[model samples]
Target: MDARERLAELVQEKGGSLAGLSRMLGRNPSYLQQYITKHSPRKLEEDDRRKLASYFGVAEAELGAPKEKSYDANQEWVDVPRLAVDASAGPGAANSAESPFDSFRFSRKWLREQGLEPGQLSAIRVVGDSMEPLLREGDDLLVDKSDRPFRDGIFVVRLDENLLVKRLTSQGGGRFSLLSQNLSYPPIAVSAEDIELVGRVVWKSGRL
Candidate 1:
């Protein structure tokens, strides 16, 4: 795709508004909107393009800047988007906007070791104590968006409009229970068709 398309995708992926991003760039709130929709400036200014590339953690050329003949051969880290899922370990509305709030870098080797691809991964925060001890509140979790098969493990799922993070135990048939690590929280029996599996929780990190 072209620069405008790529920019639009990034903005949408982050669940952000053009006005907000324009403000961040110290431009008028309508700057991006007009630029994208109306083609006011025709092409992104160098400074604006640079800021946008930095903000999105992408190469400048991806947005609209001229590409170079060579890239850094020593680059070892790749960024994984941290989405604002605010997913609670218990039953809660995943109704909040799903967008990239920030990014964290991991070594390419480390990601490969975990069988994770940066394009298929996102990070989310635990919001409740339902899965305490094992998954504490305030923990940052790395979600593998590609692991959607039924498995007996923790997963981030969407039921109707609600988003949830819990463990799934297959029940022979196409059924499973949303299990909580903490016994205080009872299990929720659900059919596979009722819930939209978001992805599986693959890695977690947080304070002790």
Candidate 2:
């Protein structure tokens, strides 16, 4: 297909409108529409094309370039939605709306090795220094919504309408202690009825 057709297909796949793509690219609202419908500029500029391709998580070749493979064909990908809210590692952060802002693709093979199901997984950002050393600020945690059995490990819990990421230690008798990696922060003890288990933290990723 032609560049216009390819661009239109990608925009639709991303659930983005031409006007929205135009604004994201710092162009007039009508810029993308005109380019897609009419032959005004004939094609997208190199920079605009690269930006749009990256935003849609697709190679430039797929968005109307020569028919060359830009990505590995043997690699399988699964898209995981990234929630907009932060699972605070220190003080609890209120997360009234659990909406997703973006998505990240992971290799299916790697996910299988980790025994992670893509459908039941979500990515949330960590916002505090309580779980430092292991999980630093700005770390992205992969949570398993299906694995909420209250085991003795790290988990994302909701208490008093706020979300927190803490290490759970089962003290028995429906009681547990939330431990933090940082010693300066004190552990919190709570009964089963007091806190709600959001999900278990299965994996984490952050910059070095």
Candidate 3:
């Protein structure tokens, strides 16, 4: 059993298929498969290799450990915050476990792939059905505070110091109405002076 054999075992034990591993490393699964199957000793780009190593809970050198396929997925779960299943809370709570004071490091390429513009928006977790069908509960929403109000769409608003996400409806007479997508919830009317626009939803993503 050599390094390649060890890597294969690690991947399998960690519940990482070639495709899932590819996403973490930002590489093609087919290409990785060739190297893993053929002992081709293919070199990974520094960042991608680092990410893969991190995902595997091992150093780059250890990725080649001799074939003992014992790995724990729980080791990797620590970084992710526990998400609320329903819309009990707004996007404000999704990554709330994260320290606001801690600096965040993210791949710019990944952000672009998710249709997020850096510094223009903040990410929030949706926990309620106020905006449903269009934006489901447990979805991640990106809000761009700098985005000015234009046509009607979903937006996060702060009314009376409470944060909520709702559909913005522009009515005549300089008034706006916040309507919930779910019929079960009633609409809230706001005067132009009282409404504080937090940001508009630029994009959303969710895990199935």
Candidate 4:
């Protein structure tokens, strides 16, 4: 069935009213009902359309009436590389693999230029401010697994095998430290062996 018809069924199954769906999508309740029941689609901006799709657990193109020529599967293909999330890599880590993502292509290119290589490099969505002013939350990070660690450079490391993005600095002795760009957060220190250097960060690009 078409998106509107499917949405009507999904809303009923989920015990969600048009008002509820409107709230979930941050849309006006009345407008949403008209769009869904009457198939009179509204001219929502792209971001709003994306948010609506995410709220409905559907694709952005499916937010309104089903468009003609909408079922071109080849046009929608994504080239995903296998990426391991270290946190979820225990016991059946192999089973919980996520589809490959293309967020880190440039970072992968930079790694290759530096002679550190991996089968593939993927961009990871940043979620914390541990890297602070330098790297904000939601910034995409390029991690190069084939590159070795350096004394003073930003790197994506798995501490005790848990993934983290921080700066590696020499602590004077046999110890190395993870430094945070934000002054409020303290640094982390550990032995070289305990830290697994997945890759050094070559470049970061994002607006505040």
Candidate 5:
């Protein structure tokens, strides 16, 4: 059976309605039902397909993921969890609720070349337009959780009860100025103890 048929079968087996599954995918309640019955939009977006495959514990290829890439038998690959939380550039993502909704596969050699350890990494998406021109909405960022030294760079930080992605500069005396690339937003000064560092954004897995 094809992807649509397979998805329909899975939804049936899970004993849930298409509307419920659509909600789980954060889409309109009729999203899946229309996709299955009407086939509008022609195909599922890659992110949505990947998320469904993970949630259902199935291979992405089974959901029509471009027949999968061929990997060398000896080359090592790593799976980095893509947390389902936005690192907002504007107003922060409140409470920073997050969980691994999918994963990104990268060759082990590539990670080593970048001096990034696989175990100390996670992926998240960008939101809002504060860091525009450099980082845009929907860009996927590879975060280095182990590289937590005070430094000048784009980073994910927790301020108050919200999570944000901003450039940080040391203000000395245990203080920092959160800088935005867009410059339309003003800088925020906070003590080093007040800002919780989530990770440094090492690379963006989006268009150049």
Candidate 6:
């Protein structure tokens, strides 16, 4: 299709709106709409084109240049669903049973090196500071739902309808202590029957 059509497709692929992109680019909300739908400017200006391309992680040619090739054709990608729930690191957060709102694609080879299967993985945002210094608020975690055996590691647990992310330490007598990185919050003792292991937190991503 044409350049404008390609731009529209890229915005949709990124799960963003034209208005949002316009605002992100410091233009009026109608700027992208006018360019794509009205074609008032006929084509994107060089600077504007470069900005859009950079924001969308695409080549400038993909935005409008003729006889240009797309960059993703030869790339390997694996789509990981990002769930709408938050795994609280402190008290707890309400878990949402809804499906994913969006997804992120990672390199297939890289994921394999982590020994994780894309189908068995899901992502959730972390909330609270109990697990601070390692997992901060608003951090995203990749959980391995299949790894529910529960050894001594970080996990997402459901306790009394609240979802939590905490480090689990095995205690004798069929009990475990939910520990937090921050020393202010005391560890909580829980029986095996009192908590349900949701998944193991295999990876985390957020600001350093």
lDDT of 2: 0.78
Candidate models: Cα lDDT each: 0.77, 0.78, 0.57, 0.54, 0.78, 0.78
Candidate 4 whole-model C-alpha lDDT, 0 to 1: 0.54
Clashes of 6: 0
TM, every model: 0.70, 0.63, 0.47, 0.47, 0.63, 0.62
Ranking by TM-score: 1, 2, 5, 6, 4, 3
- Return the clash pairs for model 4, or none: 80-100, 81-100, 104-123
lDDT by residue (139-197, candidate 2, tens digit) is 99998866434569999999889999999999999999999999999999999998988
Residue 138 lDDT in model 3? 70
Q: On residues 1-208, what C-alpha lDDT tens digit does candidate 5 reach at each position?
A: 8889999887676454777557656788789888888997588888778667654545666666775532222347667778888888997877434556677988878888998766567799999899998899999999987744566999999898788999989988998999888889899999988988989999897766
Total backbone collisions, model 4: 3
RMSD (Å) of each candidate, 1 decimal: 5.4, 8.6, 15.4, 14.0, 10.4, 10.3
| Candidate 4 ranges beyond 4 A from true positions | 1-99, 103-120
Which tens-of-lDDT digit does each residue in 3-55 have in candidate 6? 89899898776554787567545567789999988997898777667556544
Candidate 4 structure quality by residue, lDDT tens digits, 53-162 = 43333554564524552322223232212233422111111222333323232243444466643332345555566666778766666554444436588877776536
Considering lDDT, which of the candidate structures 4 and 6 is the better prediction for this target? 6
Candidate 2 off by > 4 Å: 1-75
lDDT tens string, model 1, 1-208? 9888899998887555898678656678899999889998798888777657655657777777777722222347776767766778776755645556577877878877888665567788898888888898889998886643456788888887787889888887788899998899999999989887878898899997
Stretches of candidate 1 above 4 Å error? 1-64, 69-74, 147-149
Global lDDT for candidate 6?
0.78
**Total backbone clashes of model 3?**
7
Off by over 4 Å in 3: 1-117, 147-149
